[model samples]
Target: MQCMNWKLSDIASVLAVEVVGNPEALIQRVITDSRIASTGDLFVALVGERANGHDFIASVIEQGAVALLLTQAPKQPVSVPYLLVEDPVTAMQQLAAAWRLKHQLNPVVLITGSNGKTSVKEMVRAGLSARDGTGVLATQGNLNNHLGVPMTLLSLRDEHASAVIEVGANHVNEIAQLGPLAAPSVAVITSIGRAHVGEFGSLDNIKRGKGEIWQALPATGGVAIVPVVEADSEFDGWSFWQDALAKHHVIAFGDMANLNVNRGWQAWVGVVERQATTEGQLVRLATSDWGEATLELPIAGAHQANNCAAVVAVLLASGLSWQSIQTGLSEAKLPGGRLRLLTPLPDLLIIDDTYNANASSMKAAIGVLMEQSAKTHAFVMGPMGELGDESQALHEQVVDFACEAGVNAFLASGSLSRSLVQRFDVQRPLADLAVASEDAQRLAEALWQVYQQKGSMAVLVKGSRSARMERVVEALVKLASQSAN
Candidate 1:
């Protein structure tokens, strides 16, 4: 938050609100939570299920907020200007959209998809920051929603050369509506899978919802980075084909041979070839924008192949040299719980892909688990959520996938876990379990007991956000640490 380049009048105009106090007051910062309210901050009162920002009005005034933007002004006025709007949340979003355009956070990359949104966002941020040799504004944590997008934009300062905003949606039209607030120069969809099929209704609906990002791009001079698919029929079939006729540039990634783009558009293609390495893999990417180069993808996992390719396309589109892309990605730190490797004992390797889960991601984790050399390989997970009517079948597919991948043991917890155990192709886990979360000692003891049965073992743990699976990993690691001591 470099001092906001805004005044009460400017915000009022953008938000279609009327100022109730000094219109000339300048805003140095904008905050929703009154707890963080301080001098020069424009505190916008928003309504949430748990609490209402309006409740904190007096507290914000006491803390010296320069102004207030709320649907209703407080009964007692204080030492601050106030902008009364129909809705302060909408007002804040209006300000964010306007601010992003004014600041010129060039090439604001908006990433959305079923999986790999965070990893790709991190990679793009690291790649761009490395390429530019400066700090870049990227989404912090998993704040990638309606409120999160606006908040992310408002955090941008003059120093940032670029911004990577992760846009997420549980249902249709969520990403579509976030476009103006994001003011993205580029938009990329990582992949569409069954992660949130419940809210989206079906895969085709998911395609339409995710494809809305492209529509959010500026009609002219915008860029759409999409994974190459066998067919674009699902993206509103004829409508998506007509999109190829639109003015924006399309950069297709993945197996380019499978995607056809001969529709009189300036289409750019990026291809990825991967060779496995111990820590990660060497990605050989060739793109129409920057020609050809091979870089070591810092993250591990065979499933990361398409993600690496998509990042390369983005980096290439941003005009980054291969050197910066390689170096920056090497230094890039992904947010926790995505294929994180842990060695509690010499023979026991733990793969934590617990960031979030869907059928595709779980299958991918199983692929990674199979690559490990341990005699005993266990996959521990909770039931995947938001899978809609197909949840039961999808859960069974996990068991089938593990079997096909030749996994040695399966350990899971959730209502569906027991049923999953019934379909396993390999031996069941050595120990019974209860959910351990936030590093509960009992959970660690249960997980550790399984590794006790194997001379050398590798375990993969994953679950959806609802599963709180990282706690399982933490508990096991803590128990391992205590055992080592």
Candidate 2:
């Protein structure tokens, strides 16, 4: 694909910025980091929580950046062209919108939810790319937030046959802002759960935030793929979603047979059957729209069934044949740091799901680890962040389920780990539990000892982003390597 170019003067007019040096300079790329800037790239100076991009203006200019997008006038004289605006971040979003409008992309899919957003986005990309002559682009990694969404949109080139963008927000009105910028042809809400309950205050508020994606759809027409929520779910009375999205086509995918059918509503009822395999598991998905098909998913977790189903719904709505959808699902792979299995030793297995966590994901990871037939099953976890007042209670519930599942040990770390360790009095009879002293390597050593004792062991490591539970996965691999040597 050829690089997308925007004239400095055109970008300034779009962003309402004043051009300083060469207004005619052509910007072929947009980059935020000075370390990654190339010739003809427009360096956007973003003020972030930890670092300020303005601090590296000279560095990026020296590295051949043709122009700069700045929030303020440069402190030092620079030979490169530049544009000054009120806010570089907002300017970046406006610039991306201008580019998206210029390209007029079709079948752009915007996905958001408390969980499964990334997985569903990746799955959709896989399904789209499986079609002959289709070029697909997606948000790289967890770049689903405000700034990241703009970058993803701006990265879209003319060659893309489809684009799958992940829209993420923790608080109210956040998705509302991103939705218009994306203006997706299809909007997908994978599921609403307690991912950031602390920020939103309640699940109802989260539903309001997630529903903003559908609200962003053009009044002309669009498609919305949402899960058929159960009666006991926190989002039971989300019928308002239909009213808000009345102008659009809405499709529902889930296990429920009695899905609330609203005006212009189409539903794909499906059920998942899981069977254990030595590598991962086999999932048989029987859906009303596409009929029955079994897939060998290399990743472990029952939640994957829902994620795949959401992908299938979107692909089918996009008018792809069921044969292509099946081929795509068979080739789907979860991004790293999710429920990925690692066999560092012949007798040891690690279910590394350290990408991020919450109440729902924690239980799902434990379920996958329990699928193992190892003599000892252990869970290494950290605190689920953004849970505010209920953090302690949620931690307690996690341990309770871990014990009820008959795991041999619950190896935990983080600020909330103490909650599980303190409950050992009642848990000791059911299983062993301990909290690490904030040292991941030390925790890995203790877990390694537990695994060594049992002839075969399977360990599930998971936590929120702040907890960096992936460190434990790394530590275990390092220790296993040292022992082998």
Query: Which number leads on lDDT?
Result: 2
lDDT of 1 by residue, 5-119 (tens): 5788988888776788799998888888888888888888888899988888888878888888877768775778787788666776788888888777667899998888998
Evaluated against the true structure, the overall lDDT of model 1 is 0.77
- Taking all chains together, each candidate's TM-score versus the true structure is 0.92, 0.94
Candidate 2 achieves a global lDDT of 0.80
Candidate with top TM-score is 2
Q: List per-candidate RMSD values in Å.
A: 3.0, 2.2
The alpha-carbon lDDT assigned to residue 221 of candidate 2 equals 81
Clash number for every model? 0, 0
Instruction: Give lDDT tens digits, candidate 2, residues 1-485.
Output: 57877788988899776789889999889989889988889999889899988999988888889998888788989998888788777887887777877765667899998888888887788888878335787899988887899998888888887889998898999998887787788989888878899999987888888988887788868888877767566755356476876777777776644354443465564545677787556767666556777767555667777677778778888888878876776677789997777887888888889999988778878888888878888888788899888778888888888888877777778776666776643666556436555788888888888777665888899898888988989999999888889
**Which segments of model 1 are wrong by more than 4 Å?**
232-245, 256-272, 425-443
